[model samples]
Target chain A: MKSFNKKEFRHGLKRGLPIAMGYLPVSFTFGLMAVSGGLPIWMAVFISLSNLTSAGQFAGTNLILMGAGFLEITMTTFIINIRYMLMSLSLTQRLDKAMSLPKRMMVAFGVTDEIFSVASMEQGTLTFSFLIGLIIGPLIGWTSGTFLGALICTSLPESLSSAMGIALYAMFIAIIIPPAKKSRPVTIIILLCVGITGILKYLPLFRAISSGFRVIIASILGAGMGAWLFPIDQDVEKNNKQEGVNQCN
Target chain B: MQLERAFLAMILMALVTYIPRVLPIVIFRKEIKSKYIKSFLQYVPFAVLSSLTFPDIFSSTGNLTSAICGTLVALWLSYREKSLVVVAISAIVTVYLTGLFL
Candidate 1:
């Protein structure tokens, strides 16, 4: 607290502008989906305000719209969000180890894929001040975009609205393609993950399960298969976490 | 008006999402030295994001053609390392224009 570095804090905020801007269209779509899916405007905004997760919010909102069981919603969201654990854990490595518990708690709340990716890429240890600055812009942007999307979506024409829905997925693809092109491991893993997801989506045997569970099963099994096929040493994690986490994690 | 039900779902979802994000940051106060665990964590983001993107994207826009075209545009731009906003808006434009044809 006493050692607050304004420069790094400003640096974090400056770096965060892109993330905040990127979040607008994606969260806007989330708002559209939540409202169009029959949620109240306040509820849609509440989900974005509280959850701050893209896939988890989408899957959970669908479950809510469908009157899905509580267990189903919980399990689906937990599965969807499990990756953030990894992101936060990896972030711990770059953090200023002496960072206070209160600051740790605050910064952890902002560790989205995009924030973690950018913060991880920063040279040298990360400070709490910089993290707060980084978190503020994207946090404000995500919540506000959700609000904007919720308010704006109701007036849009159907075709335009439907077209805008693809933006999030487009962002998702934008995230993975670059790394998949550069490395053998990333390539194999992306294909494997996508294949498993496809099977869950298309296969008759899995028709009884909901899409949320399917995503859960697909991601877990796919990651497991990827880990088996391409196990990384500690160095891989240490070395690679910083090199690139751009586009969506 | 299932506002109450939606509220319940939101709270549950928030808690579930919150735990995964906070637990690792709070509990792991020290560096994680376990190689197997580190390896698993390393691939989690990629595995999760990739799975979420495919097949799911196809259904998002309600029109397969527009979705595919948008995804292609997005991939091309991101591969070239365009900013996320540029990539997203351009892909959206691709979807919108293709949407017109469809």
Candidate 2:
């Protein structure tokens, strides 16, 4: 048991390190945007700490800038983040059966795409230490980056800040490219969503809908289509592996 | 005063964000038994990722040229299975420099 616990901890930290490294630049941009958009450094940090979601934070910040109402922002965020619910659902099946409710809850809070990918890739029983490692590494990296970016924003010139802002979009391109190559459905979804968003942004009638609404509508439409086209087969190997690990324990 | 209002707004935004993050963990503690629900969950990530990527790819600026250039560069790198960091940095640099020159 002791050896098993140690191994899980080590593996968790190892997996988390790369994620933390990636999050730094991304979170830094989020912090910079938050401050530039007139939020206080503390407020920026608080938002990053509490939410820990990049795209949603960016969208929320824009909505605030656009003078969106409280209800609008809430609904927008809910729609955008509804995907996490799905991620958590998938993760529940992967979790160790012996995991306590509290531990499961804590781990679920940290279920981002990167964490989910790393966790899903693990070959054996999902341990609490592994989830802890995933959360701790990224949490530290993300918060530190936000702090650094917020502090630097005041010192930097507008032009440089704007240039650095390009990194966020760059990160998105990075995310979209890999899956797009392997999955025609994914590529088509991106193209379709982009086209629809463009049309909606330009059309006179759609101008009445807030950016938040537009995003929610676009996400629902795109996600619905993707789900219809490329369904995921639940891997029996993963379930069998978990069962085998449990029997050994 | 407006800053304070924005601060309040930021807090409100954070609260709203936390609800989605925390709710599933709290509400759906058990493994979902329904095959249909599982199937739906499986596709949610792809869809959300697509929607998130789309607007940013095009609307980073009012102009379509930078977006087009960026997309072409990104597609090329992605097709090559280039590292995400490399693809992202290359696209941004391509677009930013293009904005300056063109």
Candidate 3:
């Protein structure tokens, strides 16, 4: 509570800008989808404001639009969001131990894939202020984009919006490709994930698996294989030693 | 009743989503000891992101040709280590321009 690092926050904001921009088109599409599917504009915006998750909220909204039961929506969202468990757990390694429970809880609220990826790649431990700064822009981008898309339903040029459908995925590619190029283990993991996902998606026998589960299954298998193939013992030892020092600080 | 249903659904969805995010950060304060587990966590982001993107990316723009063009553009830019914005915007522009012909 005493240390509000404005510099770190500003750095976080700067780092988050691309994430916010990436979110605009995707959330805009979400807004358009929810409203067009007959949800109220306010409700669509509310979902974006509260959920802050891309795939989970989209799947949940689609279910609501289709009159799916509460249990179904809840389970589907939980399955899709379970990936955050890994992201959040990964983040605990980098978090400044001085960060309070309240701060961790608050920061955890914004741990989307993009934010986590950025934070994980950071050279040192993460601070609460930096995380807060990182979360705010994308949050605003996501909520406001949803509001605009809900309000401006169908008016935006079809080609432009359709083209925008690739924005989030493009950003994902941007985040992973560079790292994969440098690291052989990461390259193998990416290939494994893509191959597994393709088979699950295309093979008639596995087609019954939901998209949410597909991501979870693919991640576990891919990461599992990577870990088995390339155990990063030195990195873990260094990280643990660093965390111990941070805790003492 | 309909409004109530939507409200309930949104709240439930938000709750389910938040728990997965918060629980691990809050509960696992200590560092994981196992190198394999650490490696798995390390690789999680790339794997999750890759799984999320593929096949889905191919269908993202609603036209296979445009989507492929965009994916190629994204791969090319990102391979060169372009910023996220540059890669994304380039792919989007490529998709839009490709869509014109399709």
Candidate 4:
């Protein structure tokens, strides 16, 4: 058991290093933004530590600055984060049959896109030790970046800071565009959601829903529509066929 | 202190953030058994990413010119399946240069 734990830890460290490298610049931007928005270093670090969510933290911070109510913050965060539920649900199929409940719970908490991508790609039964490496590795990188960013924001000029802010959006594009290009349905879903959200921001009815509700309603509706149209059975068959080729190899 | 409210706000924000993250894990211990629910989960990422990406692409500079330049650069790079580092650096450089020019 100890040896297994060590192996898993080592594997996780290897997988997480690349992801941490990607996160550093992005989290640095988050930290810089937080400081520029008047947040303290400690608070900025705390946000990175607890939330560990880039988009949600950015949106939440802006809403707070806007003096948005708790309901608004809650709704916005929920909307932004609802994607994790999907990640978690898909991940369960990949977990070890004998995986303990507590470990699964802990692993679920660390389910970001990068982490999910890495973990999902792993072969064999998922273990708590593996999950720990996954969680802690990125956590260290993300928190340190934010902390350093907060400390150095004052020294950096506005132009440079603004440039760094684009990192998060860049990361999002990297994630969405690849899969979208491969699948017409995926592209449609993305365009549909963007169109609906754009309309909501401009339309009076959606304007009344608050930014938080706007995100939530748009996400739920978009996901619901996509699911109704493109069932997962098709994907499963596609994956199975691909898996067969791998097995033959 | 200038930092006090931001600190308080951060703590409140953290607590709010933890609830959403932790609740599903604690409550939904079993796999979601419903097929429809599973299908819904699959599409959420596309929707969320789109919603997040579009507004920022257009509004980051509060000007039409920078937004257009950045979006065009991003679209071109993405269409070619270029590495993210290349796409990001090109877009940022484009925006920064545009800002300097205008």
lDDT of 2: 0.65
**Off by more than 4 A, model 2:** A1-6, A13-19, A36-39, A59-76, A113-125, A155-159, A184-192, A195-199, A229-249, B2-11, B33-35, B61-64
Residue pairs in clash, model 3:
none
**What is candidate 2's CA lDDT for residue A183?**
53
A1-249: candidate 2 lDDT, tens digit per residue = 231376677778877776676677778877877777777888788878877777677777777777788777777776666666667766776677777767776786687766665565466567888778768888888888998888887645433344444454555555555555555665677776667766677799887875545655775676567656654445743453254211210
| lDDT of candidate 3 at residue A150, scale 0 to 100 | 96
Candidate 1: lDDT of A36? 79
Candidate 2 per-residue lDDT, tens place, B2-80, comes to: 7766677677766666666567666666776654455455444545555556666565543467666777787687567
Q: Comparing only chain A of model 3 with the true chain A, what is the TM-score?
A: 0.92
Worst 10 residues of 3 chain A by lDDT: A240-249
Kindly provide the TM-score obtained by chain B of candidate 1 when compared with the true chain B: 0.83
> What is the Å distance of residue A215 in model 1 from its true position?
3.4
> Higher-lDDT candidate among 1 and 3?
3
Backbone-clash count (model 1): 0
Candidate 1 error regions (>4 Å): A33-40, A63-72, A120-124, A233-249, B2-9
- Evaluate model 3: give its lDDT: 0.90
Q: TM-score of model 4 relative to the true fold?
A: 0.80
Clashes of each: 0, 0, 0, 0
- Per-model CA lDDT versus the true structure: 0.77, 0.65, 0.90, 0.69
lDDT (10s digit) by residue, model 3, range A1-249: 548989999999998989999999899999999998888899999999999999999999989988999999999999999999999999988899999889899999999999998888776789898999999999999999999899989756889988999999999999998877767788899999999999999999999999999999999999999999988886654664344211210
Best of the two (2, 3) by DockQ: 3
